[model samples]
Target: MSVILESKSSRVCINEKGAEVCSFVLKETNLEYIWQADETYWARHAPVLFPFVGKLKGDSYTYNNESYTMNQHGFARDMVFIVEHQEKDSATFLLKSSEETLKNYPFHFELRLIYRLVDNDLTIAYQVETQSEEMYFGIGGHPAFNIPLVKGTNFNDYYLHFAPSKSRFLLPLEGAFINLAEKTLAQTNTSIQVERRIFEKDALVLETKGENAFSILSDVTNHGVVVSYDNLPYVGIWSPFPKEAPFVCIEPWAGIADTTDATGKIEDKKGMNLIHPGDVFERSYKISIK
Candidate 1:
């Protein structure tokens, strides 16, 4: 298909069949970590899950009674990512789970993605495997970066930083009708809003504050780009920045979201991940330009 992978300073333009990283061009001179071309990050490398971020509403969800058609972080980025290996900078993409993805995710899977570029940092490795014996899955990373990217950078004089405060903010779940009035898997530290309607008002599920996982969105205030995750549990800071969309999707997830008391078999959904019967799972994340 159209799997273009270039990054030996051709400035990062990866699209291994929606393993998604469509163009991150920064020729030679830089206006900081370029990003701007507006919304489009569906790089679901492994058995799916990651911006399709979090939702369970109408993309259809119900298991056991056998009803599945996941969309919104599950169902793996539209589809197409299987080119086991590549070199010049590093690349590997794959997707497995069928009878058409188990007829909408019933289980039996394999999702692997490994894209690496050294000097300028770009290492995305997400792997998952399970032929059955019990199954459930989650893998993540939706790379997006382009702000003011080139022309007169004015996205609020560019300044996005977060590496200090993290106590609470897992705010966004349109699935079971707003977690059915919050039930308490709880915490508190208000003032959180990052919405862009997709099951309605999406993204803001930051539990355990990523344990210092790493986050720095910049442009002045110390240059930019530094997203590191070798064993991520959760991390996301999306941007349709002030709306009109222009790159900013820093995500890393192992699981979380869609918990209004879930039981949607796929081994009880919610933060899923149950690999057995041939089990295998690996995870990695890193981005450069700082």
Candidate 2:
């Protein structure tokens, strides 16, 4: 099932499954910003990564001396979420830990995805609460926007503008795991062109030193998107490998994949967030249509 939220300038559609945003369209030009799932390239629209982000060592992790297996990006994106609250321009979907989730993520917790649409912007907030003495997890956003945004423009015409011009470093992935060898992605440049070759090595996992924000802009048209996050340490830019897909994903992650020599323990996983009982963990990112 899906819920529709409308503002004066835009309309957004979100599905109960995955609490994913299926569409974001501007009323003025009627242009769709959110990528429409195309199986020929990629099948998901916007999937929320939770409990873990990216790939894990051996696709499994050990917690409390027992082993539990999970696939890439964890299981939240494939699970159905209950609509806990709704309004004209906002909605909250809730997912609670159950027997099935506990089998792989042995913890009692509640995950809430709250989406609010205002004017030409959409803000997504992730909230996690644990009933157990302690809980370890990661959460992130994978919202792909349609490239070329305008009909006459080509994908190559768009570029990503990173804020606060300075040198940026990327943690390159070694076979789906972090290699830990930081490489300079950009030097004193505020923008990078959109191209298929950039993603040939998988997602560009970056560490931005200042305000975490970026914008997709095109030389031919004024239509684009600006994505800004609050307190997310890492940002990822990706598109399907070697596919020349019609969209690009801007991701904000609280945790990253395991290092190549990781010990396979959930607690030991790099970048994972931990929360104790009676505490709530919250993070949010915003998408503003241009």
Candidate 3:
């Protein structure tokens, strides 16, 4: 089922399949800023990443003394979410651990996704509560916005503008996990041009020791999206087959992929957030389209 929300200026569709956004349209311009999930390039629109952000080293992890294999981004995105609340401009979907999930994650928890639309801004909030012992997990957002937001515009015409112009480190992936070495990213101060060659290596995972927000702006269109991540330590920018794909993803993550130096223990993976029994983990990111 698809839940719809509307504001005076825009509207969006959220599918229950993964609690993912399928479409976002600006009412005035009739413009679609969110990707349409064209299978030729990429098939997902905006997927919520939970428990794990990226790939686990060796596609497995050890918890306590048992080894479990989990696919990239965990299983939350593949499960159906129940609608807990709905209003004209907001909706909340929820997913709780079950026997099926415990088989792999072994944690009892509830994950809530609340999406609220106000004017041209959309706020997506995540809440995770633990019902068992300490739980180690990660959560994130993978929202792909359409490039060349305006017709006749070129992808290179757009760029990511970072405020305060600070130098940051990029952690490149070797075999799907972080490399031991760090590379300089956006060293030119601010505004990194969006080009295909930039992603020839892979997604640029900005080390989150500094700045936590960024804006996607186009010199030609003079309009774009601003993403503000509250308390998220990692941000990822990616586009599949950058040359052919027509979308770019701005991701905010509370966790990260297993590092090259990981020991495969779930408790020791870098960037994992821990929640004690009866405790709740809350985080959010906002997308403002201009």
Candidate 4:
């Protein structure tokens, strides 16, 4: 099932399966900013990553000395979410822990995704609450936008412009695991031209010390998107590997993939967030059409 939200300038469609944003269209120019899931390259629009981000060390982790298995990016994205509330330009979807989720995640929790549209910007907020003594998890946003943005431009014509920052580093991946040896992606410089080879190794998981914003811009056209986040510690830029897909994903991550030498313990996982009993965790990011 899907829900629609509209503003004076834009129309957005969200699927209930993942609470994923399937389409974001600017009304003025009839331009669709979100990627249409074309399976030849990638078949997802904007998927919500929860309980885990990226890949596990061995696609399994131990909790209390008992081994449990989970796939890359966790199970939330494939689960059905109930429409909890809705208004003209905003809606909330809720996912409560189920028997199916507990077999792997082992938690009694509720996850909520709240989306709001204001003018040309779409804000997505994530909330998690758990009843267990403590919950360890990761969460993130994987939103892929059309690269060309405008009809006349090509994928290579677009580049990513970062907000001014002191330094930025990328945690390079060895296959699906993180390589602790960080590489300097930029130093005061703020722009990287889009290219196919940059993602040859996979998503560039970035850590920027001072800024949490970036944009997709093209030299040939004025159409683009600005992505900004709050409380997200990592940012990932990715596209389908070796496929030259027509979309680019700007991800905001609260956690990251397991390290190559990960201990196989969920509690010891790098970048995992913990919430104490009766507490709630929240994070958010925004996409603005320009």
Candidate 5:
């Protein structure tokens, strides 16, 4: 069933059949910024893309001498999950590993998404609990926020501003993890071009310095949301969106983009998290409008 829960401070919407947002829109400000995409597909709030998910070599990969076929993004973001529980400003949703998924992923696990609203920020927390010792995989969020921006505005007027601009950033090659191609401070407050292909070369990796905090802003004003990843290694600015929509995504990833160097084995994938059997791992990100 479709569920929309609201608290005095936030709102959590779960498509149950698709992905359940722990907290997307907050009761704080003008952030009712969910996309109008039909619930039948992806609903614009950070999508949880994961697990040997994401486009792989020829849309195929090898594991233990066997090849597996799966979509680029994981199935969690693509299925109707069960509403495990909820209360006020928080909610928990789950999806079980399936026989169908076992064909490609080959693991038993429970995925949970918990959202909470605190102060002026809306936090999306992702948790993965492993039920098998087989292998663990990659996970990330693809939340597209409305630019609150206008059309005709060239990406040249936009600058990625970090509260702690002195912090280091990562270098991700087209389809790879957040490793240092080079490390440097984000001192640039100028326009940069926009293109979907940029992602093709590799994600513009950041040097979070264990502090996943940053923002994508327009030269127009001080208007933008401050993104705080729970020490996430990746935070990206992407609008390469068609002119029809003034939307951009500030992605917080525990994982990184896949690369030509990818070893094909999910366990061999760079930045792949290894959760001990029965261990539950959790990560989160917060977005506060300034």
Candidate 6:
């Protein structure tokens, strides 16, 4: 099932299965900004990554001296979320850990995703609460939007412009695991043009230090999208390989994937968080369709 939310300038659809945003349409232009989730290139729209983000070494992790198995991005994306509350332009979906989840994650916790629509913008807030004495996990977003948002524009015409920052390099991923081999794309922060081959090595995980927001713009088209990831520690840009896929994902990650030489321990995984009992972790990111 899916829920619909509308604002003066936009309309959105959220699937109850994963609380994933399936659609985001601009009312003024009648254009869809979110991906259509075609199985040919990719099979998902916007999936929430929880408990874990990216791949685990050997597809398993050791927790409390015991091993648990989990795939890339974890199981939250495949679980149903209950509607906690809803209004005309906003909704909240909740997911609590179960025996099924504990078997793989071994932690009691609650995950909530709140969607709010205001004019041409949508904000997604993620909140996690720990019920166990200690919980180790990661959380992130995987939202894909249509590239060349305006018709008649090629994918390569669009580029990502970041806010000013110090020199940085991207940690390239090999089969979704950090390659450890790095390269500096920009010395003083600049726009990185979107090309067909940029994603040949998988998503480029931009180093998070002093980086926050970016705008997806085109040289000829006036239409684009701006993403603001205020507190996120990392951002990922990706698309379907070798197909010149029509959509692009601008991800805001509070945690990241395993490194090439990861030790397979949940606690030692880079970007994983540890939450004390009775504590809450809250973060959010915003998207504006222009």
| RMSD in order of candidates | 14.5, 1.2, 1.5, 1.2, 4.2, 1.5
lDDT per model, in order? Answer: 0.58, 0.91, 0.87, 0.90, 0.62, 0.87
lDDT by residue for model 1 (1-290), tens: 54444555545555555576655444466443534333254322222353234656566666568787777666567677778887777778888777877777676777777878866677778777777776666667656565445465444545444444445445455533235354334232322222343213444445544434444444444445667764666665665423556555667777655666565444565565666877677878777764
Q: State the lDDT of candidate 2 residue by residue for 1-290, as single tens digits.
A: 89999999999999999999999999989999999999999999999998999999889999899999999999999999999999999999999999999989999999999999999999999999999989999999999999979888999999998776666778898879988865556542668889999899899898765467788998889899999975888888999989989999999899998889899999899899999998999989999997
TM-score per candidate, in order? 0.34, 0.97, 0.96, 0.97, 0.79, 0.96
Model 1: colliding residue pairs: 34-146, 35-145, 35-146, 35-147, 36-146, 46-111, 47-111, 52-72, 52-73, 98-101
Residue pairs of candidate 4 with colliding backbone atoms: none
Question: Could you give candidate 4's per-residue lDDT for residues 32-125 as a string of tens digits?
Answer: 9999999998899999998899999779999999999999999989999999999989999999998899999898999999999999999999
Report the lDDT tens digits of candidate 5 across residue range 1-290: 66665656556566676564433564556455445453443345567776743456566667678888777666777777787887665667788889877887778888887766655566778788887865667777766665553355554555556655454544544433333444455443333444444445444555454665666577675556667865576666555423434555667776655556667676677666888786778887876654
Model 4 lDDT at residue 144: 96
**Residue pairs with backbone atoms closer than 3 Å in model 2 (clashes):** none
Stretches of candidate 6 above 4 Å error? Answer: 181-188
True lDDT of residue 95, candidate 3: 97
lDDT (tens digit, per residue) of candidate 6 on 29-103: 899999998988888999999988888878899987999999999999999999999998999999999989989
Error of 4 at 186 (Å): 3.2
